[model samples]
Target: MPLWWHLMKSVPSLQIVLHRIAWSAVIVGAFLFWRDGRGWLKRALSKPNTWWMLALSGVLIGFNWGLYIWAVNAGHVVESSLGYFINPLLNVLLGVVFLRERLGRVQWMSVAIATLGVAWLTFRFGQLPWIALALAASFALYGLIRKLAAVDSIDGLGVEGAYLFLPVVAMLVWSETHGQGGFFDGYGVAMSVMLVVSGALTALPLVGFAYAVRRVPLSIIGLLQYVAPTMQFLIGVFVFHEAFDRDRAVGFAFIWIALAIFAIDGALRARRANARAPLVPAASPR
Candidate 1:
């Protein structure tokens, strides 16, 4: 999606965001209808709190998307990568604070270490890592809202997309009037098609994430979340060739060490849990 956004440099960032959301809404909305039909939609829409929660989450995710796109397009891919890297830790903090969940001692230590890593990065940069911080905070809050709401993944997304649809449409209309719309202008069929397909690119992974979070513990989800940022970081360093001096490496090293500790702790607990489970004897035939 970032690559596509970069290619569409002629288009306004807001316009790109709107186009992606509009298409994603159509794709996700269709999937919801196919899976549950009108019944589930009606049930989901009936609750007022659902709407309120979805509305707030919608704004958060929308901002996250826009900022991330801008970051990638503005040659800040490394910073964008850093944002996702911080997101899982932020989720842990949110879980403890808002969800009233208790972290293990090791987990707390890991958080402290990660905090130090972020602090190091901030000191080195001489400015707040606002992009990383914003992405982490927004996504963590979005997940918390969805978890508390206890809505089905597809249903929640459909509602969230609905909330965004109107404003996106208005933006598109404004772009068209201003003669800056990329969709109909001479941007070529390939570009237009790519822009349209951005919807699926945006929505599918989110559907999977939303579904998984409902079924899994947030901690487990957090551990798994590192895969995305790690890949992004590799892409930024190797592919985009972003600066990675010794000072930045030291900061990242701390984060990686923190992750290693967190992963080992989780493995130990899982193993202990498995060992403690009592095996059941087979029932004798009557």
Candidate 2:
């Protein structure tokens, strides 16, 4: 993702997002066609609720992608990392408010700690961490809608791409006509190729994630998600050499502690659940 951000440095962030959507739509749409043909799509489109939910999710994800790309290219990768770090906590809050889900005492404590961390960052920065908050909220909402939509992951993504396709095409055409387009604008062969490949870059990981979620335990998946933001944090601090002062460190430390608490709680729950399940006996005749 960082590499893609770097490669797309010269292109407008919106354009990068548009191309990603356009390319991803083609790839995911193809995969959906191959996997389930038109049947899955027909069923999905037959429901008005599905269309509404997907349209909302599509917009949220588009905002997320555009903002994230802009943040990375604008040298705010650390802030972007913070956004993802806050995402799970935001999900918890959203569930409470929108889904009427109750939080256990430990979960409440974790949320409180995370809230403090966000507050501290806001205080030190003299402004709300809008980038972080926006990213977290948008993605949490997207996830909620997808959950409610209850469609196959690949098929849902195809629907999202379909919603985004026309706007992107219009944007690209406008850019080209106005002589502001990056593609074929003398950026050379490698970049043009990268621009085209961005579609695969965007879609393949999502397909992999969708596949893994079905097989992996939710606890493990939840814990593993931190890996991406952690890498982004490292890249921002060490590779990109973004500014990191003591105050920000203290704030991030609070969030880390909260995450640790959340993760341990989830692990314990998973272990208990596993222990309570009935064991199957081996077949002697085999």
Candidate 3:
């Protein structure tokens, strides 16, 4: 269903995202409460320290989503893809600067290559890749907030979303209050049903990512992270009928190569980590 909606966005972008998220949130929220019962809600909402964390991440996620939606709608998906392509490198940079972690020479080169790719893209286009930059900045900040929040991924998403969801839903409603929104008018009833589905749609990928985050090696996670964006990039050009000029294609190719270097670095790090230790299972022994 998520893939369906994503593909459907060829006609319209933000509207589809809005509808999908609205639906996904409903189901995801219900599942959270059901699976964890009141425990989940209490954990997410009650901690004062967590509240600030949630709010910050919530706002950042909202910004990220909204911009991505807008970018797709405006036929800027190529740039948007560039943003996500840049994200991993930005993640590494954040680790160094914010977490005070050391970066090896290879990591520095990976960053430099990514930087060159962005500069090349910008120079070829004669403008900054705002869509990509905005996506990278907001998402990088979200990652920082997530790490510092120190809450379980599931609980944190719900909490931060709880903060932002209302205003977003309200605004969507308000935008159409004068009359049914162009997007919302037809099958108003059906769309509403779908909107309730948004919560689940919203939660599932995170759940997939969360599962992947824990179960998969970071090298694998880094590799898998590219899947969704790659799909988006293809859908943009092939499915949505967005243009992919020669220069833009070259830009993306370079980003992909740079990402390959980044992923290799991660794999090497993971390999060394495994070599240095018991390679103990994450699960504790009874």
Candidate 4:
């Protein structure tokens, strides 16, 4: 979806984000109403703590989206890919620390190798990859919040969208009145359509992800998640023709190797577990 930004050269990244938030609210809100009417929303609202957690998650995801859009447009796509590449490792570490989950020997080694990759990138780049780090950290936190929250994924997304909806709409209106709105500034019909569809593109994947996460094994999801960042990296290098000099290549190689080890170990563990016990269907998230 970030590649879609290439067609939106004239649009401000922030404006795109506003559109994403506002329209995602519309889509998810409509779905919730159609599915369960207002009961789910009312139940969510009655609990202040739930909404607060969702609101914070909303802020983190919004930040992640805005930064990612800007980075893709500003020629930092490769670095953006690196952020996602680091995210699973970060998630594992977060789990170990926050949830008291224990990491096996292989997992720890994988984390150590990934850390070395980031260190190498930092050393060779002569500075920290702040964009990458921020994206990873924000998204990791978002995932953590969502995992801890009691609400269903779509409903949680709806709540988050609701939290941002009015403010984002007001901002868009302000931008339009000030003649700074991309949707109304003669950017053409195609740009307007892209902006509108961005919301569906955002919500659908998340909904699908929520559905899949329940049905799929964690190790399989870990492997599948790499598909996205891998495509982004390929697009950056092959399509955008971004630089992939020797030093950057070396750094990425370390990360790739670490991911390989991590994935292999997870898959093996999962296979053994399945063999030892019959597979049980996971309960749907509520």
For model 1, the stretches where C-alpha displacement exceeds 4 angstroms are 46-48, 209-222, 280-286
Per-residue C-alpha lDDT of model 1 across residues 79-102, encoded as one tens digit per residue: 787777777678888888888989
TM-score of 4: 0.94
Which runs in model 2 stand beyond 4 Å of their true positions?
A: 281-286
lDDT of 4 by residue, 176-233 (tens): 8888886865567888888989999999888898899899877778889999999999
What is residue 35's positional error in candidate 3, in angstroms? Answer: 2.1
Error of 2 at 201 (Å): 0.9
TM-score (C-alpha) between model 1 and the true structure: 0.91
lDDT of each: 0.82, 0.90, 0.74, 0.89
Q: What TM-score does prediction 3 earn?
A: 0.85
lDDT of 4: 0.89
Best by TM-score: 2
How would you encode candidate 3's per-residue C-alpha lDDT over 20-78 as one tens digit per residue?
A: 55655565677788889878878766655778877888778877876886676667766
Give one digit per residue, the lDDT tens place, for model 2 in 1-286.
9766876798888778888889999999899889888886787677569998998999999999999999999999999999999999889998999889998999999999999999999998899989989999999999999988988888899999999899889988999889778687655678778877999999999999999999998898999999999999999999999998999999999999999999898899889999999999988995
**Ten-residue segment with the worst summed lDDT in candidate 3?**
1-10
Error of 2 at 76 (Å): 0.3
What overall lDDT, based on C-alpha atoms, would model 1 receive against the true structure?
A: 0.82
